[model samples]
Target: MARIAIIFLTFVCVFGGATFVKSIEEDFIRLPLTSLHSRSRRKADVVDPNAKKVNLWNDRNLQYGINITVGTPPQPFILHLDTGSADVWVPSVNGDCPYLCKAVNKYDSSKSSTYKEIPGKTFTLGYETGGLSGSVAEETISFAGLEIKNQVIGIGENQDTDLNSYPLDGIIGFPWSGATSQTDPKSTILGNLHKNGHIKKRFACLKLHQVNEQPGGELLLGGCDVEAEHWGRVYGNGYWEIPIDKVEAFGTDGNSLDSICGPGSSVPDCRATFDTGAAVIGGPSYLIDPIASKLGASKYDENINDYIVDCDDQTLGNLEFTFGKFKVVMTPGDYLSKDGNTCTLGFARLDDLSALLLGDPFLRKVTLLMNQEKDEAGLAKSNIDKPVARPT
Candidate 1:
């Protein structure tokens, strides 16, 4: 869903202490997200002894997720619900992997009566952070209170260092493109629920909190509570889609900032996909360069191919954008990752990608309601409200 950058070693201090954070007026299920960094190597050119003859992944300072249940009796483990890529997988307990994967949760087929092996099928997933290698198998996976039967999943036999020290046991793919191989052609787990008449609608809402110990927000599988006061006006429902009407940057003094694209000019108004899985905002260099300069962000560092910034600078104004009629502004806290004195810009340049990507940094300020059936997405300013019950 998003790209990763090589993280430089820096001391981390909790800028904001713990709090019971709320998400856009409590219209969705509340899930917790934590900031994580990997103390692993970044190169994939050399083969890793722990990874079996396969390409590895690398990176740092990303999001870590919560526990999910799999198997008949329900074995719970932490898994990343990534909308960017599809394929539900976990590390293999039987794998002879490196010490890096020693802390990961593995699946044991023999422990679950519902588990079945799909012989001769291997599953491998590559990401900026690392790679995962395993086999295809069938098992039951449940979310909230809904359950899907005989779901295809990948079991990891090998994992590279990028995946090491992660607080995740596996990953669950939740997008339209949800298959790992041609042998299987089916909608994602949530999609299947809607198709099989399990859910009333093919929709989900995600509201992620800022850094906190106890956060509020959840993946609403059936859809958001339109009855709820905070449910923003639905714009596009297909995939949280929005048009980038224009881009603007503000200096520390709230004045108009300059960029290579010129001042306040529309940058083609490219399409942007709102993704919870991506940690950084990505677009063409032409669009991002001016923003970096205005923020006083540092030039590109070849070591990471990204702009690192001064984390402690708070005088900057919000990086604003026009989405349809909505005005979305990203404050310094939203666009800057400040850990001690080591600060970095949340922007990543992907000149090759035509669509501008609004990752967690943007999603953090808005509520994303996605309706898979209609292929549309809705955005609205988050409102704080009384706590709501989570879907079981």
Candidate 2:
């Protein structure tokens, strides 16, 4: 294994297909790509090479992870941080992943390859794009200041998936990536540590860029701006499942632009995932566009759920979501992130708009913490414990 620095948590994944739009429900492949070739051929997945995020691979799935010590070898990788899908993944020496594989050449495993296999547990992760399938093994995964060991990790099988001839020998994750994307099984590592008492608490926080805009900034894990006393003070959600307390499209008034309220509960109905895999926020029908139409908000039929707006309106308005005691207020400027030469910030609606899915656009505005052990999270101001960097 090539020498990787301390595991960092970062992320990169795009919003593809119709389901990516909030409140929209579409058939999305929940499994990791058997290979890169299965590029989730759909409406939202493809990028306009000439668009704002000049980097064609500027999706959120690609920017997750930190470093981890498997025995003594330093392994690095990114997490998908997807709420739309499930399972975890890592880059393996197998084959089949053409579309999303990035070759790191030969991993000089001469230093010390310290990884333990978990015998019979098989792990599979997929998407409309591709996936990483492998067996569950135990290894030591570490971040900047913390470490988790003996957690179940994924190992791809060559014959089973199409891992591009030179794919990343890293990870595909669902946990938030504010650390490093070069670590293997980062979410499991963090969750295992918290569950096994290795750590009092663990967190996974993220800062994401919009699906359509570019020139935005990052996400943080382990309470970046907020200093932790025993590390637990670092608020992060390595894993989480939250209820949508509220979803309102703000008009120029910075208030709820749309009235999505009649839904019995104040929030949306669905297992909201704090994922690094998806780029745009996603949701089921009756929750996203329908509500938008109800409020007379502007929507686009880019022929895809994830759409770009010529939004010179500046104020995408305020969309608030409450979790526990925290009531997060999302401003239009957050989504109106000053990126590229675009006529406006990017925004989209899912075809189904029933179940709500929060993506990078919303994540970057608030601090999303994950607690896999408790299936809970700490939602704070994106600038709560961290400094919010303005788009340059």
Candidate 3:
């Protein structure tokens, strides 16, 4: 599968009305999320020994992340919780490149008692915009109150401008272990946790809140939350991809326009991966072009490689995607991004990708449950009212 390069501008708009304030009764491990723009810090009220609440930082509505400690004394680094790829890496303090590595936290192996070097082993991951090249090493990783001993991790010696530009320290990929290039499947964090009996269930739930909302989101490990209203089975081995039956557009007339990507459409059997790392939706030009045109987006801008739409357009309605019997809808507010005075359609063109990539634009509207063990995913209208609590 080809890696899709992601491009997005920082935009601001309040969607989904006011934040839902509901109490969670279930007991599940909760990792609290903090917005990058938020100046105040809210503490989680519920506390459990098995439940760890880490501060997940939302970076300008583009990436959601959490802090993890590596090595013996537990050197902390804020890492992007990315579901699109599989690999864990942090910049090395000893790396020759100082410009990029100095911007964020770096791991120094010599300072840790548990750090183990995997000599001659190296890893490389390429994205559409940036890439990372590093050496393989092993250390104890502490996350969400669990310790993954001897977890394989990458020590970045070289970094790209795109990767270093972000405020994040590194990335913690959530894709299947086999999708990783740096280590054996058994060495991946999720793989090691399940193999070592650290987590009873091999499932996780992702809840991403609106950028303006406090406690940006929560990542629940071990089980799905009860808030979900819809469910869908996932396909493919590497990505958490679900079948997309068809896509329909609605105009101001409140009537459905012609649909695309079904049995009789130009493209059928379309699938999409929910990528937490990405900020915008990406799809083949065939699918994105029609949607953009119907939404009144201007001709494609070669400079940004995206279509621009009027920020005040009132005729834009909704885009609905069907997966089997479950349907997920994105209102104009969800698909349009406002950057300063210019508004751009949130969808991008990735002609070479086999499946559509649904990023933050789609994620923020729903609660997603991913069961890696069963290769299934569930979706629900996002009703995040409180911090996620561990199941008792």
Say which candidate scores most in TM-score.
Answer: 3
Q: Could you give me the TM-score of model 2 versus the true structure?
A: 0.57
Global lDDT scores for all candidate models: 0.55, 0.39, 0.66
Model 3 Cα lDDT, one tens digit per residue, 1-392: 21542355222222223322122222454443322211112222111224323335666677777767899898877777788767788888976554444535778998999999999999877766666687898889877767888888888887664444245666787874455444544445556667777666566677887666766678766654343334456665577787777887666665857576777777867887888867888888888887776655656876766787777767766788886555777877676766678777777887877677889878887777776665667675577533322111
Predicted structure with the largest lDDT when compared to the true one: 3
Ranking by lDDT: 3, 1, 2
Q: How far does residue 284 in candidate 1 sit from its true spot (Å)?
A: 3.0
RMSD of 1: 12.6
**Model 3: CA > 4 A from native:** 1-6, 9-55, 96-99, 185-187, 227-231, 385-392
Better of 2 and 3 by TM-score: 3
